[model samples]
Target: MQPAVTERDLNQADVADAARYLAGRIVPTPMLGCPELDELAGTRLLLKAENLQHSGSYKMRGATVAVGRLAAAGQATGVVCQSTGNHAAAVAQAARRHGLAAVVVLPPDAAPAKVARAAAAGACVLRADGDPHEVVRQVHADTGYPVIDAYDHPDVVAGQGTAALELIEAAEAAGTPLDALVVPVGGGGGAAGAVLAATGRGIDVYGVEPYGCDSLARSLAAGHRVPVTPAATLADGLRPACVGALPFRVLRDSGIDAVGVGDDAIAHAFRLIVTHLKLVVEPSGAAALAGALRVAETSTHRTVGVLLTGGNVEADLVGRLMEGSAA
Candidate 1:
């Protein structure tokens, strides 16, 4: 197994601490009960609409905790990171809150709107050529800024777990029981966080990834983290080449199961969200709902929480995806 995250960094205690730190920084997104989805799922269906979250994604939660730690430790000589999109925006916003400077290295192929948004968030956004992942090293070497890996860092992972923590707490307050949670996987930080949060709570957490980018699934089967050349799918945000070592061990050790879905099913999920739920979710966000649908057949869980991770897709892309979908 890959090296585990230190017990002290963003462990259970740190999760609580981060929750307290983020109470005012992040909004408590709703657990929207979709009756239409319930019918389709043949059970209680609730969505943790993190698309409504700060920075328009759950990354804000992790970003806040991670940046806050860095800032407090005086490691805040500014921070640098490479992202396809969402994580950069999250980091920019979080760094701003802590009065720290931020620079975002974005892949040339990243969505234009995402690049613009990151720049608008007070980050000095730079377009990197060639290998996107290598951009992190190049920027770090050139700028001497701390390189924040999108989903590999322990504090970030713990901060992401706050979403699950809040969702589970909300379920209790609402007098509803969360039998399971389904989250999308790319770098697996979110899924690892969910597993960490759900532990000993009798809630099963499962991760979903597109068939085109089944890095975590491949790694899980191989008993170690593995790399793959992700095929470009509609869910571009979930196209990481590999699951981070930290998340890989956490998911496996926590017994979280992962499932891969085809692009056809993800398109169907997009239709479901748009027509029935009336939510504007990106293709990557829709993966959680699609995974819930897949798990429903085999899972005995009644009330499954599906996390809509973000709503950052461009309208033109949605229109293009909708054109091919008969649903």
Candidate 2:
């Protein structure tokens, strides 16, 4: 396995390199837009539809890179990871593709669809009610499997950045350069990647979190990492109790703004995305749009980019959300 990469070892150039490495390997999900949605936001909104990405989320990019490295090293027989949902599924799928045994530790209350996806990809799915990180460490120690951190690993961050890199490039190609970029923050991996991808490009990056689950926002305010017992919210994927150490290192003093969105706003964004964009975005992904609309309200950003991070929500939840919208 590779040595652990420090934040000092990562930079915008790494994101560029990751994009190159991922070219033709991961899905280049389309940059989509809807006039009605844009009009509602009062700006030109470019949505990076990572919900359409492989493994049903942008997490596939990072999982593939991290697992591919382990496979290439040939020193490890398997891989282990812990996540609320998407990362586990992505790592499972990536390991399967690379012919590596995979074990995923998830919370007992993890989304059913997400759990099914990981199992479907041939991973040994385990449930732990306690801290998943501790379980991951134990799994690594016991099985000798390299642990692919969902948000902290440098390669993972670099891989996640490719999604934002593609979005920025697509926006430029379309002659509507983005003034800002918005991404949902769980452990802040994707947001940190966004900061890297938009560096030197003058695009302001915003990390969105569910209101009571806003560890990133709270950490920024505290000027250090602050842990929160995440509250119940529609965006289950955004419920990490703390922003990841590596991601915090990348985001601290990076001038990236943090936005706290509520479940009501997330639900509204979900409705808009489904109704106008015709996309099956999970509430966690919808938080990006909710945060983008908030940014549009307070800033002069004419062109904004939002990364719709994933689409692996439960079917019943979708029906309930849609039904709620109709009522």
User: What's every prediction's RMSD, in angstroms?
Assistant: 3.1, 1.8
TM-score of 1: 0.93
> Model 2: runs farther than 4 Å from truth?
1-7, 325-327
In TM-score terms, which candidate is top? 2
Which pairs clash inside model 1? Answer: none
Per-candidate TM vs. native?
0.93, 0.97
**Steric overlap count per candidate:** 0, 0
Give the winner by lDDT.
2
The C-alpha stretches of model 1 lying farther than 4 A from their native spots are 1-10, 324-327
